[model samples]
Each structure stands twice: as C-alpha cells, then as structure tokens.
Target: MLIPFLIMLREGIEAALIVGIIASYLVQSGRRHLIPAIWIGVLLAAALSLFAGAALQWLSAEFPQKQQEFFEGVVGLVAVAMLTSMVFWMKKSARTLKRRLQDSVEHAVHDHPGSGQGWALIGMVFLAVAREGLESIFFLLAIFQQSRDWAAPLGALAGILVSILIGYGLYSGGVRLDLRRFFRLTGMFILLVAAGLLAGVLRKFHEAGVWNHLQQVVFDLNDTLPMDSPLGTVLSGLFGYQAAPVLGEVIAYVLFLTISLACFLRASTPDTSAGAPTGTAMPAVTSPAASSPASNA
Candidate 1:
C-alpha cells in the first residue's frame, strides 16, 4: 500500500506540475482561451492510460502461470527502466522545466496562429500528461503484480488526489514548494524502488525459466524474517526485501542501487560551467513563484 502510494504520489505530482505550469503560462500570457484545450488533453491522456492499464491487467489474467510470470517480468523490466529514466531526467531538467515549458507555450501559440494554436496546445499537453500517466500505469502494474494486495489501488488513488490538491495550491499561489529538495529526496527513494523492481524482474524471469544461472541461495532468513510476516511484507512491498534471496537477485539489487545512487548523488553538484544552457536558471529555494506558472524544479 505504501509503495503504490508513494509511486503514484510522485507520478501524480509530476503530471500536476506540468499541467499547472502550462495552464499558468497560458493564462498569464493572455492566451486563456486555450486553457480548455489543456483539460481536453488531460482527459484524453487519462482515458488512454486507464484503458491501457485495464487491458494489460485483463490480458495478464488470461495467461497461464508460466506466461503470467513472463508478462509480469516484462512489465517489471519496463517499469524499472521508466522509473530510472524518470528520476534522472527530472534531476537534469527540473531547473529548466519552467523556462522550457514557457518557451513551448510561446511557440505553440505564436508559431502556428489560428486554429492550429489550439491543436498545438492540446497535443503538447496530451503528450506531457500521457507520459506521466503511462509511467504511473507501468509502475503500478508491476507493484500490484508483486504484492497482489487490494489496498494498493486505493493507496494510489489517494496519492493522485493529494497531488491534485498540491498542484492546485501551487497554481493559486497558496503553496510554496522547494522543488529541488523535493525531487532530490524523491529521486533517491525512486532509485531504491527501481532497484527493487529490477531484482524482482530477475526473479520473474527465472520463474518463467528464462534465467537459469545464479540459482544458488545467497542466504536464507525465512525463519528469522519470513516474507509472510507483517514487517517482512511491508518491507517487501516498499523496498523489495527478500528473506531468502538468491545470489542473482542480491547481486542485481546491490549493484543497481549502488551505481544509480552514486550517479544521482553526484549530479547534485551545481553546474558552474560557462557553457550552461540559456534560460536554465535555478529557481529560488524560497518559493516556486520565483519561476512563475509552477515549480522551478
């Protein structure tokens, strides 16, 4: 439950931030007429994401046990990839996000005047929302496959609701978020989650008879901390903890987390080179209002 909640919360916040930024830019730029297009795009993206998730779940249900493992393994791998890329991309782009968005809005409105403007806005917003929505879908799907808990969906729904409220607050100028700090912290958590998912993917593949090597037990803690225990269950859901992990799973989890965390932490160094990209100013830590429209991160 907690795992899905956090993943959805992060994903929801990202989508909300993008929509809020675009909407704010349109309104402030006197292009409020195109605002409805944003909603249209969001609705379309939501519909598509919902449909895709439902289809995948339905299809998985029809598969035999071995095939089910294969499907889950494939989805888990995709989720891991998407989650990792999202973390790194957000870390790199957060600073320039606002400016880049505003520039896109400007181009959308000014580059193609008339009806084309509305279409451009809709397309832009759709792609942005859809990307986040789809990422959430894959992440949640893999999580649900692993935990098989009824509470996971409810937790995810709660996260999305909270994110909507936060996005609204930011847009209304009633909330101030330290995006740099927020993303930095969440990025670390996501890397851990992704590492867990990657390990799970290996297990899934092995179950489907796709991976045969590294079959030896690295350690057995079933009696000490059985997976069925309450604490173990929670840990499994949140951090991919395994009581009797095999050698491969242990190696994969440790290696992925170590290298990913190293890269993520190292990127925290502020770029001071003279070749810094134009309009990539970092927003003030005091308020996202410093960047306008949405968070600077």
Candidate 2:
C-alpha cells in the first residue's frame, strides 16, 4: 500500500509539473486562447492510458500458470528498465525542464502560426501527459501483480488525489516546494524499490523454469520474520523483502543496488565551480493556469 502510494505520488507530481510548466508558459506568452486544447489533450491521453492498462490486464488473465509466471517476469524486467530510466532522466533534466518546455512551446506556436497552432499544441500536450500516464500504468501493473492486496489500488488512488492537490497548490495557491530535495529523497527510495523488483524478476524467471541454475538457498529468515507476517508484508511490498531468498536472487539484488546507487549518487553530485549552478531548482508557476501549461497544448 505504502509503496504504491509513494510511486503514484511521485509520478503524479511529475505529470502535474509538466502540465504546469506548459500552462504557465502559455499564459505568460499571451496564448491563453489555446488553453482548452490543452485540456482536450489531457483527457485523450488519460483515456488512452486507461484503455492500455485494461487491455494488458485482460490479456494477461488468459495465460496459463507457467505462462503467467513468464509474463510477470517479463513485465517486472520492463518495469525495472522504465523506472530506472525515469529516475535518471528526471535527475538530469529537472533543473532545465522549465526552460526546455518554454522553448518547445514557443517553437510550436511560432512555427505553426495561427490556425494550425492549436493542433500542434494539442499534439504536444497529448504526448507529454500520455507518456507519463502510460509509464504510471506499467509501474502500477508490476506493483499490483506482486502485492495482490486491496490496499494497493486504494493507495494509488489516494496518492494521485493528493498529488493533484499538491500540483494545484504549487500552481495557484502560492505554495512553495523544494523540488530538488523532494526528488532526491524519493529517488533514493525508488532505487531501493527497483532493486527489490529486480530480485523478484529473477525469482519469477526461476518459477517460469527459464533460469534454474544457482537456485541455492542463500539464507532462511522465515524463522526470524516470515514474509507473510503483517510487518513483513509491508516490507515486502515497499522494499521487496524476502524470507528465504535464493542465492541468485540475493546476488542480483546486491549487485543492482550497489551499481545503481553508485551511479545515482555520482550523477547527483553538484558542481559548484565557476558559473555552474550550485544547486538543483525547479521553476515556480505563478499563474492561474499553471497546471494547465504543462499539457504541451
């Protein structure tokens, strides 16, 4: 539950920020007439995301037991890849995201001139929101398959709701957010989650009979704290905790965390020499339609 909630919260904020940047740029540039187009793009993207998620869920349900395990393993690997890319992309781009967004909007409006401008903006906004939405679906599917608890979806819903509120506050209510700090902390947490998912992926592969080598029992912590216990469930959901992990799973988990964290920390280190920016910071949206601006429309 907590895991899904945090993932959704972070993802929602990212979507909101994109929309906010675009919307703020539009208003500031006196292109407020295109606002409706932005909303239309958002709705369309959301609809598509829902349809895709539902289709995937239905399709997976048709698989046999072993096939299902294989499918889950594949999905888990994909999720890990996507999640890793997302973390690094944000870390690299967050500082300049606003400027880049503003430039793109300016180019879209100016390049297309009058009537065609609206359509161009709509396409842009659609792509932006839809990308985030689709990514969310994939992550949610992976988490849901692993957890299989009622609280998972509920936590996602709550996280999205709270993120919407936070986005709104950041856009219009004059709320200040230290985005650098927020992403840094959350990124670390997410890395841990991803590591757990990696181990789970290996486990799933073994279950599917694809990789059977190194199935040795690394250790047995079930006697100490079983995975099905109340506290254990929470840990398993959030951090991919296991009671009796296999040797391959443990090795994979440790290697993934060590390498991923090292890279993340190195990339995140600030360079303060000369004219370089001293710290990471995101632009503030001070307009009424700030949230809408990120829509690309």
Top TM-score prediction, candidate number: 2
> Relative to the true structure, how large is the alpha-carbon lDDT of every model?
0.85, 0.83
The sequence of per-residue lDDT tens digits that candidate 1 reaches over residues 175-216 is 677667787888899999999999999999999999988989
The model with the greatest lDDT is: 1
TM-score of each: 0.92, 0.94
Least well predicted 10-residue stretch by lDDT in candidate 1: 279-288
Cand. 1 Cα-lDDT: 0.85
List the lowest-lDDT window of 10 residues for candidate 2: 288-297
Candidate 2 residue-wise lDDT, 1-297, digit = tens: 888888889988988888877876787778889988788888889999999999988978999988898888888888888788888889988767888888888888889988878888889989988987888888888998986769999999999999888887776646677777788788888899999999999988898889898899988989888998998888898889999999898999899999999999998888676455765465555556444322211
Q: List the residue pairs that clash in candidate 1.
A: none
Q: How close is candidate 2 to the true structure, as a TM-score?
A: 0.94
The local lDDT score (0 to 100) that residue 290 gets in candidate 2 is 44
